[model samples]
Target: MNTYQTLLVSTLFSSALLFSATSHAIELPQLQQRWAEIKYQQTGKQQESAYQALLTEASAARAEHANDANYLIWEGIIRSTYAGAVGGLSALSEVKAARKLFEQAIELDANALDGSAYTSLGSLYYQVPGWPVGFGSDKKAREYLLKGLAVNPNGIDANYFYGDFLLQQKDYQAAIAAFEKALAAPDRPGREQADLGRRQEIMQALSLAQQKAK
Candidate 1:
């Protein structure tokens, strides 16, 4: 090979090695932050390239910290987001992968972050469509969600998702109660506007559910 070609190959190899080393050194929190940033970008616009880059980084972080429950959960969440962006079969595969990751997290630490993994899995199971081979387990969904709520009665995600599930089941009163609990949760991590906006949306949904129940 020419000198230039030889130099290029060597540089590529060095870059790969450096990336491998750096990925191993990355922490779970950093990965989670990146995932969150990517999610924010996704909300603003359909920036596939940015999302892909974040997912690539997240995958590397996940590989380096395979035993961490938080990493596993974020990895699953990122995959699910990617799948949602690319719908159809790809989305289904992503959701399935996410479900497995959440399950793994639960297995490792069922009580982590007040049973966030259980709440996630519950919502996924409930929201995912019933199918011949993938997802759609209402029974499993309810079981996990209740488990989450049992662990932390005021868990935002658990209450919100369970409320949605109740609405689907036509248990309007139960749904309203759950929604109210979610809205009333104190000191949640988000800003006031975000939190209040979410509460407002839930209240609207609850109102609709109440009317339907009547």
Candidate 2:
């Protein structure tokens, strides 16, 4: 081929590769697995270098698969993980970014995963301190949580957060019911063993709520 024709072909090939990389869909299960590992590392107070590397890789995957709402959701979740690892101003920034990304994902696909975005947003609102003050907002928290439950009654995060909110509100019976629902949720993401462990924890929480009710 002529020199100019070869150069043109090379450019086209490079462009194609770039497009393919950017348009690829991130694997949701793999992202969740990595996130769980990050969480474990944080809990153990171990070096998080590997977790950081995993986040970088996951971020790249999400960027490549920008069209996938789940990819966006995972990206937001990883950002929240990074926030927890690095406390202070950086953590706040990361969480804020995470919230925005999650909101975007919901806007893009509200009905995805039976309204996972609602669950995520509900948790964020419930957990995050209030603006111009602290993060405790039982009323607003309950509002979002209830909204999420309306979308998906069996949603894990929604049930868990709402249960906590109810406990805080001194509505022990409601708290117990919420936690029991969380434990019974069938589609939680994570390793099988880890999922079972979480269910057990939720059950324990339910028991506590039951005691409080009595």
The positional error of residue 152 in candidate 2, measured at the CA in angstroms, is: 1.8
TM-score, structure 2 vs. true: 0.75
lDDT by residue (96-132, candidate 1, tens digit) is 8899999999989888768878888888888778878
In angstroms, how far off is 105's CA in candidate 1? 0.9
- The best candidate in terms of TM-score: 1
Q: What lDDT does candidate 1 reach at residue 37?
A: 53
Tens-place lDDT digits, model 2, residues 82-196: 7667666556766777788878888888766666666666666656667753343656666666777888888666688688778867889889888988887886545665465
| Predicted structure with the largest lDDT when compared to the true one | 1
Pairs that collide, model 1: none
